[model samples]
Target: MLTKAGWILSAPASVEDVRLEWEDGSPPGDRFGEAKARARRLLPWRTGAERYPAYSSALVQLAGRSQLYDGDLYRPTAIAGEANGIRLRFTHGRYFEHLDTTEILAYEAASRDLAGRTPADGRYRRWLKDPFDLTRRSTGLGTVTLTIRTAAGSAGFYMHKRDADQLAVGAGVVHAVPAGEFTPSDIGLEAIRADFDLWRTVMREYAEEFLDLEEAYGRGGRPLDYDHDWPFGSLNEARESGGLRLYVLGVGLDVLTWKPELLLVCLIDGAVFDRIFADMVTAGKEGTIIAGPRGNGIPFEFSNISRYVDSENTRGAAKACLTLAWRHRAALGIVSDVDS
Candidate 1:
């Protein structure tokens, strides 16, 4: 039976029970907060790119209505009213339990090389358990495509171009925003055994990438008018339009980082979304909006999926994400066939 502890994957004798253990091996340090702060400072450029001093090691996957469809096609699972968090426990033998310092460094190096980026400098401490290292069972990072739907129910997806400082996976290719790993800050260390906190990652990313937390807070204003603390509460009250709908699209393996990743779709009221986008794209607010190929500003800056799908520059897991988003546009509630 599925319980708070974990769901049963098989009969008792043969399968291991869902388990949660501290990655005691993560290089000791209190740099998690500092790393997060630095990444926050970078915004869309390298948000969460710095190798933090340490982080909680946890596995993430779909559950309780969210499921992977045929490996490629994304069947988005939508949940509303309140945030839905999926808690998954691994009973498999492949999830690594421990790693020596030397092994951790080697994994980090390989991860950088594979992603076509430089090794982590001393900016922040390195996460002992590298999710990019596919050799080991890395933490499951979640990437979300926040969709803005018009009053007419037509949906628009926001994709950004990766800058030089970011990983090479899709450097120039346009891809979704508000994506990152599920760190301990997202899922509390104490509660790791009870839940994976998937939705929390979405909310946090939404605020950071899409809403610009620093500016929002600077104005004594909160995105979505959300008056809450970290690991946010129910975002339903903050919804501006028809309401917020979250869909667990599918999973894609990052060929560059060698980590398993989850792609999610978030639908919000178009009017509210446009207002936020407008605020960021005004004449003096260029940097506030992330631009890419084709154009370098707001609505004009957003690229169509078709234009980049076949481009040689768009490759790797990001390419997979673009293809999936486009393939499932109709299922994702996108109404405009012309734009899709």
Candidate 2:
């Protein structure tokens, strides 16, 4: 059964051994910066990027600092899988996302290495519960377990699915053999794991970029425009700080993309617009968006930004639509309507 299960050889004796082999030897600070840059580069494709600038700006204005980390308060990389069906593997030292009652039982069962060599009947039953429920209820979600067997012994990992996919998708059983044993069949799982870690580091860095932009804007007293290279920086900050204020005039679909459109009629009306614009100019900052009865009027509705997507497929598609709106904000009168 073990051989039929397609399990491979065990890994090195200790996690430290794996780390020694995989550590990039770079300073943590520099490594973090590089990771953020990569994440920023990928932002154009993700909705998080578009919202990040505004969210971070708001955080700065209200909280005085942008959120740098999720502060999940649990070990990172414990749960592994796509949206659902995520399995947590804990024995290998990864501990994140608190576990719930069901998962706790499973952990106990797996720990016992029971008579059947899997999990006991009751524990196995809990394991079968919906992974989402287990995750949602639990404070910490565990890791996914993979067992590999070889001539020497058995090894496993509580690793992310992406890392597992990278390995399993390849042609052969890739073992991370120590410096001594070398074979084509032997691939280093540590290398793959390191790659996954690097990817996450980059994502956090990208988040920080927007956070910094928000800080700079808030410090400038919520400017409409700044000397920054990105023209959208000031406006993005203002929207986030609630200084600009967004009013939904109306929502409709773009005939081409089938994506939603949010109409902006104007920033400020007569007296309010003049007052705020003059104040901003005097403060050496550009003006902000102020829409209302004088500009667009009350009950002016725009597409619900938060309800943009309902499912994963639509999530990606909706983002593509939003990207179009962001790029064409000026040409389509969105910018003029708001900024004017």
Candidate 3:
């Protein structure tokens, strides 16, 4: 189990060993039709706007927005732990469908006192226990990452405090930087089919969150070429050359929102990290970047992790990413990667 994060359904696993695949199709209907109906009635939802007042008002005030298209998303269909590692699958899903489901559920739970207590009288938590539940508790995937910067004799990671006004779940909470929904690069069929890889979503978020670049998926009615894209190309090359490393700590749902999260972390060579994020924006669409350790992140150390992980302000997935990364630092080459 991911101790601090309380991953509902997981054991010890690693990203280097997990195999992932996706197909275009519909997943079974979620079991939350009744729950959604109840939550809406219990909360003060804006009638026609289809959002809670706080979430709706925040979006109206934001100066810049990250995404124009709600678009399609890859819904988790299955996850099987194999002898070698883990196997995960996804299917096609609509954006608004999720907003109307788990998004609203998160707001409902938060509005009540059910934030951390799962299975509270066999309610929302029961539905989320089985991540691959056919009744699909969640329709969207959270590709949240702990962005690590490996420097000479030192290493640390970045943090993002989500805008409570805009985000329904884990609002104003600290999270790993480059966090985003697992979705396709474009709204087209082909893009939906092609952008299922986990790294693609991570890279797109990095380009937007760190560099403040426009969303890197196919823009201008053109297909995105990962090999030629500025940040994606650089990130891929660095990984190939052993200058950057990607690892998956595990997958689970955030207790507050019960939203599925493919918890992950990326370690980058200091030189490469510096170069890529040299012009990093202090603020982006999601919220302000917590500049720390006198730089872009908090120090990835025991004290910092302990304080944050145990705090009520940190998101479950973010804490899980940090806790697992620290526990597996050796296998991840986190410390040695820089000195080497």
Candidate 4:
């Protein structure tokens, strides 16, 4: 029978669970360990790039402020309650791309890389050149002044040009007055909210599937009759498969954010797993693999066996786990040893 704690632990056991956690806790984490752990679990399976491709609408607030400054700027704004404009200026030879925009292809254009001549003629041009004009005929968006500078001393602004039609689908517009004139208001806050919500959902689903796979695989090994009341009992069941079982554990935000690449590393090296298992035992969270097998009816115990150590060993182990997950992006769907 699944208890309340089991259900709570299992709540984020799958990708779908992770998603629901995020939806309930926008930007989560402020609540401390609970909300943050859910967020980290979901991050590995986030479809944020797919849902909010090109640029996040949440960033429009910053764009609104950008217009107040002088020079070439790429600011996303709404216009006339009908279209969204990504305003930007070109400065030097380099161009900027939108975070939401997907890069499809890149190829070298003909030689237009000179100081005096317009680089725009070569399919790419420095923003500093005067009389620089480029048009996205399909989107009805065009560029006029090529060279402009910000007070901060930045040389160029890059932008992702989107069609008015595509921009209208994500958000609505409001009215703002400036200098005695009225202009359409930018409400990208909604877009950002929606994008984040969608990402949370994707992460939860992934966690669920991962747990399911782990259970199915465990069943294929040995069957150990273990206590259902104790959380540690599940560890004994996992031992039949050679020290493997579904165990649900929480991780920290620092580990998730700064060491995202570590997920990929652990997956590649089995030794990383050994280190983590050892650490858990040392932390006084010991359990067994079978109850009735031994003469005293105790389970098999595994210990931390690493001789070579360092101050950052735990950090390294965490990084390895993160690296493994990242490397096997597809394997996130596999069953997790963690219960729930």
Evaluate residue 214 in candidate 2 and report its C-alpha lDDT on the 0 to 100 scale: 27
The true-versus-predicted C-alpha distance at residue 157 of model 2, in Å, is 19
- Per-residue C-alpha lDDT of model 3 across residues 254-328, encoded as one tens digit per residue: 655556777788888889887777888878766788767667467767887788789888888888887878777
Per-residue lDDT over 1-340 for candidate 2, one digit per residue giving the tens place of the 0 to 100 score: 0011111112111111111122333322222222223223211122543532222232334335332221222222222222212122211111111222222333335444644555444433333333322121222211111111111121111101112211111112221110000001112343224323311221122122212222221112322222242424443454355433322122222221111222221122233323333322111111111122332222211232222323232223223233333344444233222221
User: Which parts of model 4 have CA positions greater than 4 angstroms off?
Assistant: 1-13, 19-187, 198-251, 255-318, 322-340
- Answer with 1 or 2, whichever has the higher lDDT: 1
The CA lDDT at 135 in model 1 is 26
* lDDT for each residue of candidate 4 in 1-340, tens digit (9 for 90 to 100): 1111221221112212221111222121122223222222211222655322222232333233221211111121111110111112211110012112111001111122334544334221111121111111001111111010111211111111212222221112110000000101112333223323222222222112212111111112333222342222433333344333121111111111110010111110123222323322211101111112211111111111111112232233232222222233233223222221
For residue 141, give model 4's deviation from the true position in Å.
Answer: 34
Per-model TM values vs. the true structure: 0.49, 0.17, 0.80, 0.17
Off by over 4 Å in 1: 1-140, 166-173, 186-195, 214-234, 238-242, 275-303
lDDT of 2: 0.24
Clash number for every model? 2, 26, 1, 53
Q: What ordering of candidates by TM-score runs from best to worst?
A: 3, 1, 2, 4
Instruction: List lDDT for all candidates, in order.
Output: 0.37, 0.24, 0.67, 0.19
> Model 1, poorest ten-residue lDDT window?
68-77
- For candidate 3, give the lDDT: 0.67
lDDT of 3 at 122: 37
